[model samples]
Structure formats: C-alpha cells, structure tokens
Target: MSLYNPNRVNPQRPKRIALVIANPATSSSTGWPVGFWWSEVTHPYYVLTEAGYEVTFFSPDGGACVADALSDPNDASGYSRHDLISQGFLHTPELLARIANTTPVQDLVSADYDALLVAGGQAPMFNFANAHALQQQFAAFHAAGKVVAALCHGVALLAFTQTTTGEYLASGKTITGFSNQEEDQADQAAWHYGWLPSGQSIMPWRIETRLQEIGANFVHAGAWQSYAVRDGNLITGQQNFSGEATARLMIEALGR
Candidate 1:
C-alpha cells in the first residue's frame, strides 16, 4: 500500500535564477575599462527579486566585477544620470557586495536554477563570445529545458554557443540584441567624447550582426527602445533599456 495521501498538497519551491556578469576587462577596440552595464544588472535584479525569485551572481573568471564607466550614474559623461535604479544598487552595501566576488561560471550546474540571465555591457563584447566554459553552461541550461536569457551585448554568447548536437544555439530562433543602429550611435558617441579615435567602432563585434550570421532570426525595436523577445524558452533583450522587459519575459517563460 502507498503511504502517500491523495489529498496532500505540497508547497511550490521559489524560482531560482543565476545571473552571469562579465568581470572587468579593457576593451581591445577602445582600450577603455569595461564590465557589466548598470541598468542591465540592476533593473533585472530589481524586477526578479521583487517577484520573490532567488537570484545569484556569477562571472566567467570569477571574483569582483565592475560596471562600465558610461553606465555609472556618477560618470562624468552623465550618460546614465537618470538611472536611479543603478544609483540605488551602487549605494546599497548588500547589493554592492554581491558583485564584489562572484561565483565562477564553471561552478554552475543546469539543475541549480530555473533560469539563467547573462547581463551585458561593453566587456561582454570582448569577454563572452569566446568563453567556452560560459558557452557550455548556457547551452546546458537550454538543453535542460530551462529558460535562458541574454541582454544587449550579452547576446553575443548566443552567436557562438552550440547545442549538444553541435548546432548553433541561436539557429532559427527569433532573437533581439544590441542592434547595428545602436552600435553606430554608441560609436559616434565614443568618438564625440574622444573615448575612441575618429571613425572607429567601440566594440570588436556587433551582437545583432553576429546573431544574424549564426542564422538567428534577429529582430529589434527602435534604437534604445525597451524591447525584448521570447522564442520558446529563449529570451533576449535589445539593449540596456530592455533589462526589465527581458526579466519579465523570463518570468513568463518560467510560468512564475
């Protein structure tokens, strides 16, 4: 005889999310310091935590992570002065500590979280595309039928990740990332601010172009628009402004 009662009800476990950020690195293109975008990390974190999801931070090489200079609200460029969310996160001791030292990406397991979000900034344009370990972890999450998400330049990983079957992970998927128009605008801004030599691009590669090259059905909204797309379990954001939209899509995918 079975010991279980048919009338018994069990409580559901809270959803767990793993947020992967890039460690600080100097941009090969601009020689500028780069890391995760402020809004890309804080906005989604704010939304996910508000939904009661448990979120953890991780990095490809582990240890402390930094935010891009322009993404910082206090940056002299004043590019992100209106980002109160990022400003609050930078001031909160507890939150600030979370990014100080992150778990290594190699330590992650597909079974440990319900979803994975790769946050982005200028650093990811250099760091994430060729990180084999990070790519494997991201592929593992997808293979396990979990929600997989990437925002802005973080989506560059999708262009290089392969499925267990050795096929491009983004093949035939409808996705969106930092678009060419946005990249052009960013490049222009960099030159205008003397951050880069005249007529030079700020990033080594363009996320949208890469995804398209990998056979993804790349899509996007207007430049700098808050836009995200969901194609089955894959969720992608257009740029920094789409962080919250991407997180909400992940929640939707997880049925939370």
Candidate 2:
C-alpha cells in the first residue's frame, strides 16, 4: 500500500525545516514549567531527522526552553510516561543535544528552509499568543508560500498572524488544533489534584473561539483523538498525539 518502509532508504538531498519554540522558564497557569510539548517537538524532530531533513530548533526570545513537567518521561506525575519515543529520547544525549543549542528568530531567514514548524505547550498560552514578533515571522513564512506548520497551543498564533497582504494567514484556510472539548476533558481529568485547567479560556480568548472568529475552517475529530490537517502547505495538529501524524504529513508534503 505505502512505499514508505521505515528501515529502507535514505535521501541524498534532504529537506530543511526550522522549528520554533517558546523561551524557557515560562509555565502554565498551574505553575508547570512549559515551553514546548514533548511529543509535539520530539516526535516531529525524530521523524524529520530520520527522513534526513536538516532540522534546526529556535525560540521566540532566543534562550534555553523547557518542556512541560507532564511531558517529562521521568516526571513524578508520569503524565508522559506513556510516550515510548519520548522516553527513549530522554535517555539519548545526542538526540537531546538540539534542545541545548536552539537559535533565535533573528538568526533565521524563512527562505533558507523549505518548511517551518511551531511547537506547542502550556507556555504558548502565555508567550506565543498575541506575540507580534512571532506572528510577523510566521507571516513571512506563510507569505513566501513555504510550508508552515503549528500544533496544539501553537495554533493560537494563527488568529493574529497576518500575511504581507494584511490578511490573517489562516483567514480562509482549513486547519485543526487543540479543541475546546479536549481541553475540557484534560482539565476535568486532572481536577482531582487541583490542577488548574489548560483550556483555551486561559488566554483572554480561546484558540478555537478565536480561530473561528478569524474565519478559519477549523475542524475537530473528537476528544483525545489524533487529528491533523494540511491545507496546501500549512500543516497543523490538534494535540500531542497528533504531533507524529503531523510530522508524517510534512514529510509527505515535502516529498521526502
């Protein structure tokens, strides 16, 4: 059915992609350290690297970034213990090395790469949303018609990013991201311990609500389900589980 064999071949001229993350030490409303979601960053990282794409990591403010505590495989909460790939990556120094040397947005030119990916986590609710600089950068990439990708809370920026034409980049595009329902489910599941909700409401506005207001063709598959959508070169994932799926789509769209 599919020509892709995980162990099979390699490409001589791999595609180049850039990854954007939030700066470190920013946390969620519940006080969890957050920058980028683990699966959202790592699964895609692993996929692109294995496919021979040259991937570079960057941050909004140019500094070290941290994953949400729940994303840590070794975390006492074990929120992410179920992620084998993350668990494996947690133990690999070489693989983890990229997170140590992330570049700043000023250091990158969108034209240098074939695609750009925005990662999500709790921190995005605080840092990425309403980020004028980040929106402008994404606008540049989107205007150039290069592949632009965002997952989970990272999708929040779509509501503010405007293309060179002064229109919201996603003004008429079909996309997907963490839905209101999923946020409710995750929040309801963690309420026993007094963990504050991570819903879209945290932002003065919610992602689903804002995206809809901006005329985005936003879709949702269901609670806790992996859902990713590609509208032309724009790739988006709904939540953590959708990260790997989104990465696979990017690879396909890049023809790798």
Strongest candidate by lDDT: 1
Which residue pairs overlap in candidate 2's backbone? Answer: none
Task: Look at candidate 2 and tell me the lDDT of residue 15.
Answer: 74
Compose the digit string of candidate 2's lDDT tens values, residues 32-147. Answer: 55567788888898788777677788887776778877888788988888898888887889657768767887778876788989998877877776467778878887777778
TM-score of 2: 0.88
Worst 10 residues of 2 by lDDT: 1-10
Give candidate 1 regions above 4 Å deviation: 1-12
lDDT of 1: 0.88
Query: How many steric clashes between backbone atoms does each model show?
Result: 0, 0
Give model 1's TM-score versus the native structure. 0.93
- TM-scores, all models, native as reference: 0.93, 0.88
